[model samples]
Structure formats: structure tokens, C-alpha cells
Target chain A: MAENPMEQFEVFKIGPSLLLNGTNVSLTNSSLFMIISVFLIILFFALGTRKLNIIPGKIQVLNELVFDFISKMINDTAGLDAKPYFSFILTLFLFILSLNMVGLFPYSFTVTSQIIVTFALATIIFIGVTIVGFIKNGVGFLKIFVPSGIPVFLLPLIIVIEIISYLSRPISLSVRLFANMLAGHTMLKVFGGFVVALGIYVGWLPLSFSIALIALEILVAFLQAYVFAVLSCIYLNDALHMHH
Target chain B: MKKILVVALFLLSISQGTYAKEGMPQLNPEFWIAQIFWLIITFFLLFFLIQKFFTPKILFTIEQRKNLISNLIKDSEDYKNKISVLENEYNQIITQAKKQAIDESLLLKVELNKRINEKKKKLADQLNIETEKVEKEIDDFKKKTLDNLPEIAGNFSTEIIEKIIGAKPNASNLKAIISEITDQEKKSRYV
Candidate 1:
């Protein structure tokens, strides 16, 4: 029988444990997958952009498409002030997307399946966006919770809800990605286990379902990354404009 | 062989230890530090690579292509303007040349007519002057010839008479007769 479906999420130390400042900063399976994603992203971008041309090939087209997609997304969502953060957003999108894809392969570990990784990213964006908001608007940044045209009687209630939503940004962002990756990968493992246990006669059934799930998972992966990046752009837009 | 067996047993126990954990290993606080730490490192590494290298080249290429297109369009527009200006100048030159040619032709016709009329008048005047001189000379020659004709005729008549009769007739009588005959000839012939 195949190992437990949950075993896929285990983080095993791949090398000698190292303690940095009394904390265990040892390299593990999760770290290995993260590094692999980084390498893959570098390889993809490097390979596609190596030869610049007026007319592009297949890979170059894909490279430009991704860049333009995020570029236009930022411009549409966050306007031109978001132009400066194009690199950060592009990196974030590529990193998440590549990590998601790399995890789809057999025997590969999904980095985004871990809550800590996604939460870390989301917290960083959330914190950075808040700082930017405060910097751009000063004390007026708090006015985002106080919407216009509301009756003074409802202002207090509206502000509470708005504040709650604003505070939940990082949690929702992190959980959305982490849950989706974890659930999809777990489901795939569970079904894969079913296929093996059922053997040749009925194996094809679960096997086909898993295959279909993979296709859906791939779409989910790309979508989650897009959602992640777009939401960040929206947050940035709010900070810079303080209105939308 | 004993060492290898012990190592395998140790590895199995370690793997078993993780599987024994409750709920999600993701919720486990133990691995959170390493995962977050590595994620930051790799995320920044990816960010550094892309920001430092990729986007600039792609942006430059795209911007260059856009500039090339816009420049070509601008150049074409400039050339189009130049073409229209040249066409206008050519048309103006043609019209100007045509106007000049018409003016010169009209002027030439006027000058030629003036010269012809002048030549006609000069010829008529010269002809009138020649005719008047010729008529005056004829009148003078007629008067002189008439004046000389009577004397020569009287002398010739006397010589003839002297030869016929052996002497001239009476002189005063001949004078009277010749004078009377000359007067009569002048009146008859001149009148």
C-alpha cells in the first residue's frame, strides 16, 4: 500500500541540522522545493530572454505574455504608482506559480502546501502595503475604513467591519493559497492511493479521476498565483490612491 | 552489516515518528521556522534575479519596437507633407510659366503690328515724296523745252527761206510773224 496521503506534507531534514541564533534554521524538504522553484524560475526567464528579437519565438512569447499580463494587471488594478513594484509582483507571481507547477510532478513536494510559507509571503505584502499607505497618506490612511456618503449613525458599525476585513487580508490571502494547494495535493495523493489499492481492474477509474484533478489543479495553481498577485496590486492601489 | 541494519532501523523509526503526529504537519510549529526562512531566502533570490536581469531587457526591446514604429509613421507623415509641397510648387511653376508665355506672345504680337504699320506709313510717305519730285521736274522740263522751241523753229525757218529764195525775207516782218505764231502755239498747246 501507498504511504499515508498526509505524509506528502511532511518536512524532513535533508541535511545536517543547523542552529542559527538558537533557532533551528536547518535546510529541509520544504527548503529544497523552494530552492528548486527559484532555480526553475531563473532558468525559465533566462532561457526565454537570452536572445532578444523583434519577432519572438514560442518561449519568448510566453515570457512576454507573463510580463505583460502582470504589467497590465498592475496598471489596471493599481495604476501607474504600482509601476515601481512591477519587479516584486512579477517575482512573487513567478515564484508562486513555478512552485505550484513543480509540485505537480511525481514524487515532488509542493512548497505552497505549507501554511508558513504562504503566510510569510502574505504578511510581508500586508505589512508592506500598510507601511506604504501610511507613508503615502500619513494619518489619513485610517480614513480607508470610513467610507463616504454613509450616515453618521452607521459609521461606527461600518468602520468595524471594514477594519476587520482589512486586518484579515493576510490571513485570507495565506489561507486561500495554502488551503487550495494542500487540499488539491492531498486529494491527488488520496486518489492515487485508491488507484494502487484497486489494482488494474478498477485502478483506471481513480487514475483517470486523479488525472482530471491534475489538470484542474494546474489551472488552480495558475489562478491562485494570479489572485495572489492581483490582490496585492489592489492593496497597493488602496494605499497609493486611498480610495479604490 | 550490523551498522547498516542499525542505520535502516533508525531511519524507519524517524519516518514512523512523523507519521504518528496528529492533524496536519503543516500546523506543526517545529518546521515553520525553516519553511518561512527558506521561503524568504528563495523568494528574494528569485526577486533579485528577475529584477536585476529580466524585465529591463524585455522592456527595452518592447519600447524600442514601439519607438521604431512611431518613428516610421512620423517619417512617412513628413515625407507626405514634402510631397504635397513639391506638388504645389510644381503646379505653381507650370501656371506661372504658362502666364509668362501668354504675356510674351501678346507683347510680341503688339510689337509686330506696330512695326508693320510704321513700315507701311514710311513707304507711303516716301512714295508721295518721289511722285511730287518727279511731277515738278516734268513741269520744269516742259516749260524750258517750250521756251526754246520757237527760237529754234524761227531760225530753222529763216535758214530754209534763205536757201529757197537766196535771201532772208524782211527781219521785222519775220519777227512779227514768228512772235504771232509762237503765241498762238502756246495758247493752243498749253490750254
Candidate 2:
């Protein structure tokens, strides 16, 4: 019988834990790696910006690159008033990007590869946008549900449609990233398996394909992170401006 | 919301077994737990670094650039004012120099004319005095010569009369003597 592809994804317990109703809440390999990723990201930025020189060293250069990139993104999409939100947006982008890239390592789990993880991120963004909308506009936040220029008779249906569209922001945002990462990784694993199954001569083809897919996956990882950030900015803009 | 429905439908479609092969990985609870924990940690750390270091430095640099530009602008304005003032002062100096030169030339011309006229008058007065003195001398010589002219003429006439009387005549002498006597008598009577 063929081995179960789902077997590679199982989370095994790694530490002793308190049992609540016979089930133990224990740390898993996935959790351990995630903690490590967080630590590494912290260490990187901490060391990167310690000097804060006018002419940046290698680490500071990288730090400034990220800073300028995110600042520009916010300024462009969200307007100058949104400068305050630059830190949050930049943090989101880096965290998601690092998590995605970390997942590509051998035997490492892609947190973004799972729907739950992406959904949590998307939900947070959704709540944030909603809060900002209400906070900025007060009772006028409902105006975002109904676009201007629709006829009176069609208004009800249009408003419903608009509301539905607005609510789907998180769903779309999360799924786009999650689906891309999951599909790309699965394809890589499949092709990688083919390299072993097919003997040496034909194996080279699948091996090469796997290599190419790996590179493509890395690109997709970065792209998805950027898309997520940009979309968030656009949503924030709608909230701030009450644009339909 | 329509968008939410669309996402639900999309998720529903992808939930099918077609995309999930027999050997494909399944979503487990541990993955979710790890992602949530790491996401929070990473987010806070990133936020702190941005807030503490990056933001302050960028703002400080921007402020410094603004101050530098303002200072340069002020300096340029001060320079322009100084230049204009210098130009005005230079023009004033040139005008004063020209005025002084014209005044000096006019004074010199007037002084020269006065000196020339004075010298001409002095020379005319000296020439008039000399001419008068020479004319007076000539007049004096002429008067003396005129006075002596009668005595010289009397001597010359007496000598001629003596010679004429010696050369000619007895009868005429007698008659002349008689006549002389008569003429003398008559002249005396007449006188």
C-alpha cells in the first residue's frame, strides 16, 4: 500500500503536559520550530538596528530597505495620514514572509500552508479594518455597505451585495495566500516523490521539475506576503475614507 | 456578505478530495497552535524595533534636512541684501567723486582767469607810465630848443648885416645914414 501523504503533516507530541480530561496539551515539533522562527526574527532585527548609523552596515541596510519599502507602500495606498500604521503593516509583512519562507525548509511546517493559520491572520485584519472604519466614521460606517449611484429600486439588492462583498475581504485575503502556498508545496512534494519512484534516467526530469517548482514556490511566498500587505492597505484606505 | 459567500464557495470547492491526494498532508491542531504563538511573538518584536529605533532616526534625519535647507535660504537672502547695499554705496562713492572732480576743475578755471586778468592789467599800467615819461621828455627838449632858436637867429642876422654894411656903400651910406636918421627919427616919432 502507498504511504499516506497526510502522515507527513501529523503533529506529534514532544513534551510532557498537563492532562485535561485525559487529553494532554503538549508542545509539538511545529510549535517548537515556530518559536525558533520568532526568536530568529527578533534576533535579526535587534542586532540589525543596534548601531543605527547614518551609513548603514549590512544588517542596517537590510533593515532600512524593509522600512522604506513598507513606508512607501503605506504612503502610496493608504495616504500620508496612515503613517502611524506603518509599523503594524511592516511587522505583518515580515512575519508572514518569514513564516512562509521558513516553511520551505526540509521537514519544516508552513504555518501559512494551513487554512486555520491564514484565517486567524485574515480575521485579525478584518477586525482591525472594521474597528478603524467605525472609529473614523462613527455611525457613517454603514455607508461603506452601500455604494453611491445605485437607483432607489435596486438599492436594497445592491446594499446587500455590497455588504456581502465587504464581509468577504478576510476570506479572500486568507484563502489566496493559503491556497497558493499549500498547492505549491504539495506539487513540490509530489514531484519530489516522483524523482524517487521513477528510476535514475526518468528521475532527472522530475528532479529538475522539483527544483524549478521549489524556486517558484519561494517567489510565490514573497508575492503572497506582498499581496496580503497591499490588500490590507487598500482595505484600511476604504475604512479611513469610507469609500465604497 | 457576498464576498464572504464567495470565499465560502471557493473553500467548498477546494475542500473536495480531488485536490487532496491520498498521500497529502492533513491539517492538525498543533500547526494552528504554533502559528498563533509565533505570530504574536513576531508581531510584538517587530513593532518594538520599529517604534524604538527606525522611526526616531528617520524623523530626526528629516528634521535635520529641513533645518539645513532653511539655513541655506536665509544665508542667501542675507548675501543678496549685503550685495545690494554694497552696490548702492559704490554708486554713491562714484557720484561724490565725479562731483568733487567737477568742482575742482571749475575752481581752478576761475582762479586761472583771475590771475591772467590781473597780470594783463599790471602790464598795461606799466606801459602807459613809460609812454607818458618818454613823451614828457620829448616835450621838454622841444620847448628848450624853441626858446634858443631866437638867439641863434639874432646872431646869424647880425653877422650878415655887418658884412653887407661893410661891402656896399658911401652915398647909400649917407642917404641910408640920412634915411636912417630920418627913419630913426620917424621910427622914434612913430614909436
Candidate 3:
């Protein structure tokens, strides 16, 4: 009745394929959307800063609201030490949120649904956080793997588990975002197909359901972005403060 | 915008079959390199722009607002303290004025009482002198009137005797006789 729903996930080059050391570095739909998200962020902040109001205009208020939210989140989760990295976390959040929102447009590519993109972002954060830990605590950062109150026999087991979980951070972070975006968009595509298959008279049912799913997907987009940033803050807290 | 959307859809339709033959296009490793490449580029770009351009001004504005609020609170507290001090000074002045007024009124009352008493004593003395003069005058009037009464009676009796006898009687002898008779009457009636 409608085109294959999976066809929407297809990635294709938009321009001439550029071989960078025999690697396909050509721009794709995913890249185009990514660039769009970046420009949108630039445009939004540009508008926010243009007026420079004491009593903020709507855009500036929105800018401040986002800043204050992430600021408070970092402050609450990681304490004062996390304050310095507020802009980085804020940037990460806005980037993901922009990508998510842009993807919701019809016939638009969702960059976040790609596992490699999410994984790459998560890997950068994981590597950065690890380096920070080493910088702050030196060899003592290794103690993050060992349980303090465990018996001697359980130490080895606990250390292995901790190391595994520690290594899994990037995977988990990446998968969480990638999976949520993939599932939501996939469901939307499927329901959109269902509306087409059901004909004009019976199509209203699936159409309404797709509308509802769209609302939920929007919520998920915001939520996943929040989670990604907050988790990063927590990881930083562990690295910087190391309460236990 | 719609043109862009239509173009994008047309592109997707034309290019779909190449990747659509697979199980999952996301799992295909062919396109991962481009996606990750752009992700890194765009992510860092956004991060750089927001950090460089917007944050400092916003933070400065927020900090200034905080300082203004705290200063306003401090000023109000200072004003409250000043008002209390002024109120205390005003209360002290009012109490002092009230005490002075009460003291002045008491002094005025005492002075008025003294003046009234002096006037009362002077008026009583004046009334006593006037009363004494009036008593003396009354005494003189009574003496003069009583003395004249005997002579008047002697003359009246001589006239009575001359009329009865058709001739004048001896005036000196009659006066002496009348005097003796009046004297006896005075002793019996006036004394």
C-alpha cells in the first residue's frame, strides 16, 4: 500500500564520493541533517544574543532557560567542580536535541538513529572523562574498580564486574539514544504506512495514532537528551569528586 | 521549504534500493564513516560557537542581577534601621515636650493660685475699711438727732402755754423745765 518503511533508513551520498585514503567520506543525508542541526544551533544563539536585553525577549529567555536547566542539573549532580564544564555539557545537549527535533520533520534524516554517530559521541565523552579522572586522581583513579567493603575473596569478582560496567559506559550511552530514536522513528514510519494501507475512510485511526506517537517521540527526544547530559555529569562527578 | 522536502523525498525514492536490500541499513558499515565524521565536525562546531559567543554575556547579566538584588536588600535593611532610629528620636522628643508642657502648666497653675489669693486678701481689707467708716457716720447721725430733740420739744411747749393763756411765757424757764422733763423721758425710753 505504501513504500517499504525500512527504505526510509537508507543512507546514500548526496554529492560526488570523496575518497579520503580510500574511505568513503562523501556527504550523506545523515551528514546533511547533522550540518543542519549545527546551523540551527548557531542561528538560535545568534538570534538570542542579537537583542541583548535586560529583560529577555522570548528567544533569550529560551536560551537562558536551557542554560539554567543544564546548569542546575550539573550543579546538583556533580557539585561545584562540574561548573567549569557547563558549556560542554550544554553544547552536547543542544546538539542531540537539535538533531532529534530536526529528524521529526517529514522526509528528514535522523542522524541520531545511526549507532556510529551516537557511539562516536559517547566514545568522545568516555575518553574525555577517563582522561580527566587520570589527570585529577592519577593512579588512584584505578581504585574506581575495587569495592572497599568487600571480602578478600570477592575482590577479584567485584573488580572484574566494575571494570566491565565501566567499559560498557560508552556502549550503554550510545545504545540508549540510538535505540530510542530508532524505535520511535521506526514506529512512526510503520504507522504512517498503515494509514496509507487502510485507505482514506479507515486511515483516520492509524493517522490519529501516528499523531499521538509523534507527541510521545518528541517527549522521548527531550528526555533522551536530558539523560545523556545528566549521565555525563554523573560520570564527571565520579571522576572529579570521587566521594566513595 | 516544501520544494526542499519534495526534492529530498524524490532523492530518497531514487536512491532507496541500493541500501534497502539489506536487513538493517543502520547496521551496514559502509555509511558509518561519513555519519561519524560529520557528527564529530558538527558537534565540535556547535560546542565551540556556544562556548565562545553567548555564555559569558548571559552569566554576566545573571551575576549583575544577583548583585542588584542583594544591594537592594541591604539598602532596605539600612533604611529600616534608620527609620527605627528616627522613630526612637521622635519618641524621645515627644516625651520630653510632654514633660515640659506638664511642668509649665503646673507652674502656671501655682502662679495663678498665688495671684488669686493676693487679690482676695486685698479685697477683704478694702471692704473692712469701708464698713468702719459707714459705722462711724451712723453713730454721728444718731447723736446729732437725739441732742436736737430736747430743744425742739421746749419751743413747742412754750407755744402751747402762750396760746392757752393769751400771752407769751418765760422762754428760759420753760426750756429749763422742759429739759428736766426730757431728761427723765430720755432715761426711761432711749437708754
Candidate 4:
């Protein structure tokens, strides 16, 4: 096992490296796991829903349950008008969730733990939502940053604050997911290292703690994914309806 | 606490790349482009696939299931309504048949009673005519016997005299004797 808990987060180039536009485009463990997660999601939905019996089988039940869960979540958060983008939001949630869960396995790479990957996803959402806002509401979309019914003197300050908060969305969104996964995995590795280093006689405490942490981390994984999806929905709602 | 210190030292030393070739590979700028590129490729491909194919398929299945259930319920309701209607018709038919049978029987009973009374009246009239004819025949026989009474009494006196003095009696006397005998018989029978 690697000595440093941080060592688990390292990305290593897997096949031959390629350079495009003066940037290295080499495939890495992160990409490999991302592909795996995508493949698993496809397989799950494809095979699970193939039969579509009136009385669903186990995998079919799981498929319907997940579908309904995301559907209801998006509907509640983004309203009925945002229904067209359900697939995109659901894909984002499943991809992140699968990546997080995959990271829990020993010797597995967590794609979401990388700031670059999360930032890329968050940036896409941010840019897409902004474009949607402009397209849907035209100049009225800018109203989101302006506070209504404020004292004349306080308008500028409040607008600046709102703009800052709006612009910081991508940063907060990306960092929250990346940091949660990175820190949780690191803690698990560190505690696990303790159990091994302390030996079996007195290591039971740390081992138990590691076990409990794993459970909590799993819960955290699910929660972070839910939070990420729900926040995206809220942003979409804002764009679609221009709620201040 | 000692374990925590050791773990912290290891993390710090790893970042320095003292023992490993890469410090923190997430910060190792060489792989960021590739990661983002692949992330985009995978995410959009997933998004398109789900949107175009999978989501629609599941939605269709759910729709089909709902329609199937509703149709079944509707068919059962139709069948229930149809059965009730048939039952109502059956009851109506049964009641109508019973009423018609009663009406027919009443008509038949009235016709039968009229026919019986007509036959009884004709038989009573025939019986009265036959009884009058029989009384007339009895009265004619009784008058013929009464007309022969004078001769029968003359003969009976002649027979008694011949037996006593060998001679006959007069016709008028015979007639008087017959009248006297008939009057005495009438007085004995009627009184």
C-alpha cells in the first residue's frame, strides 16, 4: 500500500500519450474509470429495462426507482418547464455517483476527486445555464444579479454581492464535490494505514473506526451526488424562470 | 496521535515527491487536458444516449403499464355493467312470462266456466221436457183405464149372477154400479 493517503489520488498515464494543440491528451486512470462508470451505467439501464414487465424484476425495479427518483427530484427543483433537460441532469448525477462509489473500493481511482474533472463539468453546467438564461429571458436574465426593492444607495453593494455569488457558483460547485471525495478517501486510507501499522492486537479501535468511516463515506458519496444534482436543478430553475 | 503525525508526514513528503516521481497527480498539470476531454466525450455521449434511447424506452414501458392497468379496469367495469343489464332483462322477462301465464290461465278459466254453464242449462231444459212427456203418457193410460170401468163392472156382475141364478144384469144398472164403485174407491183412496 502507498504510505501517503494522498498518494491514492494520483493520476498516471495509462496507454501511449498524445499531444493536441500544444496540450497533452494522454489517457489516464481517471479517464479509464470514467469510461467504466459510463459503461456500467449503460449496461445497467439497457439490460435492466429490456423486458419491462408489468411486474418488474429486481434490476427493472432498480431502474424504475432510480428513474422516478431523478425525475421527481428534477421536477421538484427545476419545475415542469425544465423537464426537457432531465436526461442531462440524470447523466451527471449517475456519473458522479458511480465515480464516487468506485473510489471507495481499495486501489480504485476516483474521477471526481480531481479538481480538473469536476471543474470541467461545473464549468459546462455554468456556461450552459447562462446561455439558456440569455436565450430564454433575453436581457431580463440579468435581473438575477439585481436586488429588487432596495435602498438607492445600497443597490450597488447588493448587486456586486449577488454577482460575486453568481460567478462563484462554478468554483463552489466543483470544489465541494472534489474536496469531499478527496478528503473522505484520504481519511479512509489514513485510518486503514493505522489499522495495519498498529497490528491486530490493539488495532481493533482504528479498524472499527475505519469501518464506520467507510459507511459514513458511502452515505456522503450519495449525498454529495444528490446535492450536486439538486443545485444544478436550482440553477436551471433560476435560468428558466429568472427567480431572484 | 503518533499515527496521525506519521500519516501527516507521509502526505507532506509525498507532495514534495521525495520518494515518488509524481507529487499529487491532480495538480500535475500534464493530465488535465486529457481528463477534461475524456470527461466531455463520456458525459455527452451518455447524455445523448440516455436522452435519445434509454429514457424514452423506460417512459414508454411505464406508459404501457399504466394503459394496460386502466384498460383492464375499464373492461371489467364494462363487463359488470353488461352483466347487470342482462340480469335486469332476465328478471323482467321472467316477471312478464309469469304475468302472461296468469292472464292466459284466467282467460282459459273464464271460457271453460262459460262453456260448462251453457251445457248445464241445455241439459236441464232437456230433462224438464222428458219429465213432462212421461207425465202425459201416465195420464193417458190412467184415462183409458177409467173409460173401460163400466164394461168391466157389467161383466163382473153377469159372472156373479150366472154363478148364482144363471142370468145377466141391465146396461144402465151396470153403469150406475160402476159409478158407485169408482166413487167409493175415490173416497177410500183420496180421503
Candidate with top DockQ is 4
User: Is 2 or 4 the stronger prediction by DockQ?
Assistant: 4
Query: Model 3, A85-151: lDDT tens per residue?
Result: 9999999999999999999999898888887888999999999999999999999999999868889
| Positional deviation of residue B22's Cα in model 1 after best superposition, in angstroms | 2.8
Tens digits of lDDT, candidate 4, A1-244: 4387777778889989878897887888999999999999999998887887888888988988898999999989999999989898999999999989988888889999888899999999999999999999999999999877889899999999999999999988987887788778878998989998889897899999999999999998999999999999999999999757
Instruction: Identify the CAPRI category of the predicted complex in candidate 4.
Output: acceptable
lDDT-superior candidate, 1 or 3: 1
Against the native chain B, what TM-score does each candidate's chain B reach? 0.38, 0.43, 0.51, 0.42
The alpha-carbon lDDT assigned to residue B117 of candidate 2 equals 99
i-RMS values of the candidates, in order? 9.1, 5.1, 6.9, 4.1
- lDDT by residue (B4-40, candidate 3, tens digit) is 4433543464466434455457666788887887788
Answer with 1 or 2, whichever has the higher TM-score.
1
Model 3: pairs clashing at backbone N, Cα or C within 3 Å:
none
The reply for model 4, stretches above 4 Å from the true place, is A52-55, B1-25, B84-191
**Which regions in candidate 1 have their CA more than 4 angstroms from the true location?**
A150-156, B1-20, B79-191
Chain B of candidate 3 achieves a TM-score of 0.51
DockQ of 2: 0.14
Q: How well does candidate 3 reproduce the true complex, by DockQ?
A: 0.27
RMSD of each: 14.0, 15.0, 8.7, 9.4
Better of 2 and 3 by TM-score: 3
